[model samples]
Target chain A: MEELGPLFVHPYQPDQFWILILIVSLPAIVASLYVLIRGQLPAALSSSLMILLPLVAYLLGDIHLMDESKRVNYCGSCHEAMSPMFETMHNDDSTLAGFHYKRGAISHQTACYSCHSGYGLSGDMTAKLAGMRHMLQTALGSEDYPLRLRRSFDIDSCLDCHAEAKPFRAIEDHRELDIQEALLARDMGCTGECHETAHPEEARHGAAAFAEAR
Target chain B: MARFAALLILVSQLLLLRIVFDTTGPPSTWFTFVGHPLVAAGAVLGIWALTRRLIREAHEHKMAEREDH
Candidate 1:
């Protein structure tokens, strides 16, 4: 028997599941309502069936959509998004992006929303709003926007969930540098080890190489 | 036509999933293929074919009605 992995993981919650269930059942509910209002059983049944097919499709779609690990929503939906960032990743003459993407290292499973978004409502809202703003800017022809990289990667954000499995107790040296100092230096910022590349320069060189090869 | 559209959606979803979930293995084969221009060409052709077929069917149905009149 194939052992299923952990049932509940990050981003998947009881409320979300219930909301999904409601969404999946909406067609049927709407069909029923229509039938009741019109007193037309046969029409209602047909309408219900019509709704049923799409509902199944919706469920399937929801399953795929809800997957936090996929870059479908992140990269595909907003192809123009952080274009420079993706260019840098895929352009690695050394095939760093290709290598990571292939190995699934440079995807939703590891980067973007993972470290940036904290868990629960507050995190989700912040990430989504920020994404919306980015999308708006991208659409409005504001190409000179700054990148999303924080001066210093909030190691605590990474540590929040990962601390239990991989305890990251700050050493004495780690404590020496304050948050402002870390940001200015760009030390301990995101990387392939965290969320792919921390700097645009690294991405550009890597992307140039990757594009040349392909 | 709807079926073809649904299939396209499904395939797109799969590709998106490959982008998102990293299910295509340690070194994502799907990304390489999806990122290729060939896939885009194929998708465009498929959509064009499906749309043309649908329009042809609609035209034929209208012609049949005219003949009946």
Candidate 2:
């Protein structure tokens, strides 16, 4: 009996590289399928030839799964508990997430995570950890529906992009105040009093918003 | 073919999985839930198929030797 290679190993190739691999591997894979399916393999050891097939499909699915986590669309639907919050973002870019994200204030690619995380090495890590907890909560059915912030929204995340911008600094009201002191101290306003809640109480559970999000 | 496809997919996913995981956080448990099963299934099937092929070959070799003797 000939030895067979182990199938499971960590994936480490770059994204663009797959296109090249696929280009080369796909034709052989397809041709091999013709042999495999027609029951007329070139070699009795043809099983070795077909091994790459499942691997490709699995990789594609994995890439998709990864893509889904970062995608606003995917994140919005990850749990029923947070579905409406995501819906609000999708339904009206005019809403807070809409205003900045749809307006490109944050990259649409990093829209939800951009605000949710801070501007440091651990920011993305923090978000991912939080996401894990959310996943667990979702699985356990322990999270409150329409959850509020699990932690205070770090003003730094907002300021990371906005703080130095002339527009934010130049605002007449901001010019008179120590923005960090006020926010970090939790003294008065957050995202300003008028725009306090990102998703309005009504929009949080809007049936239409939720439907369109789907 | 399906098994091969699954193996190819499993390898590809493992190799390129860094794209999704490039971020600094612990991988989402979601990844474990979805990815682990597919990988384990693919690997088990791959091993089983190989084992079956090997056993058949060993039997064939023994029979051929007996005929020659």
Candidate 3:
């Protein structure tokens, strides 16, 4: 059998798994609505109740499974969020992203959730309020904000986990380079000198050829 | 007619909430399930309650007119 990618291989959390079940139950919800519209209140209510009971039960189970320290409620109980920074990280082929998610990097255990959602009650409350504002905007039909990738991209989030790992060495090295002198000498550190582009300009120019094979 | 009106109001409210909570992607599964039904029911109940109040007020107006006559 062919090896599946990390995205497919990893088991989702219990809450996520239950959510999949809820998604599958959408057809039942629709069926109940049909019954209700037909003036069959008893049947409609019964079917709705049947679907609702399991949902409530599953919610309770999820609550129990969630960490008390990081109450799922504080993650804005009503809000839905998947930060764009995370999307960029997922899109990148670098080991930095994969290591953090794939359990290869010990520093980033419970990685994405921990940094974005600060620790303790006060942090949770702050996040909830921010979420509320976002919710309000969405409700008002004012959700057409341009993708402000910069605001979402926080180097600090990476530092929070990897500070001890000396990830800053790369930045320090970059700062040491005299870019002006290098450029004047026609010997840019980036090309034809030291740091070769991971995806070189030549390869980028013929990207279509590579893309077709993929 | 009343129920249908209620249902429409409820749906809009739920959609509003969904738009708020999930700006990046579609509303989370939990939000879709919880918010949709709750808003719908709440809208229906609210409209029904409002209609009842209007009927009561109209009946009182008729009663007052009779007393005056």
Best by DockQ: 2
| Residue B7, model 3: Cα distance from true site in angstroms | 4.2
What C-alpha lDDT, on a 0 to 100 scale, does residue A15 get in candidate 1? 30
Q: iRMSD per model?
A: 12.9, 7.4, 9.2
Quote the true-contact fraction of every model: 0.00, 0.04, 0.00
Error of 3 at A189 (Å): 30
Query: Can you write out model 2's per-residue Cα lDDT over A90-126, one digit (the tens) per residue?
Result: 6677677777765668765557777886668787678
Candidates in order, TM-scores: namely 0.37, 0.54, 0.37
Better of 1 and 2 by lDDT: 2
The TM-score of the first chain in every model comes to: 0.43, 0.60, 0.35
Q: Predicted candidate 3: interface RMSD?
A: 9.2
Error of 2 at A125 (Å): 4.6
lDDT of model number 3: 0.41
Q: For each candidate, give the TM-score of chain B.
A: 0.49, 0.61, 0.61
lDDT of 2 by residue, B1-69 (tens): 344634533443443353343322223343445555655565456545656766878999999999999
TM-score of 2: 0.54
Q: List the candidate 2 regions with Cα displacement exceeding 4 Å.
A: A1-52, A76-83, A90-95, A108-110, A117-122, A125-143, A154-156, A170-195, A203-214, B1-36
User: Candidate 3: which stretches are off by over 4 Å?
Assistant: A1-37, A40-111, A128-214, B5-24, B29-69
When sorted by DockQ, best at the front, the candidate numbers are 2, 3, 1
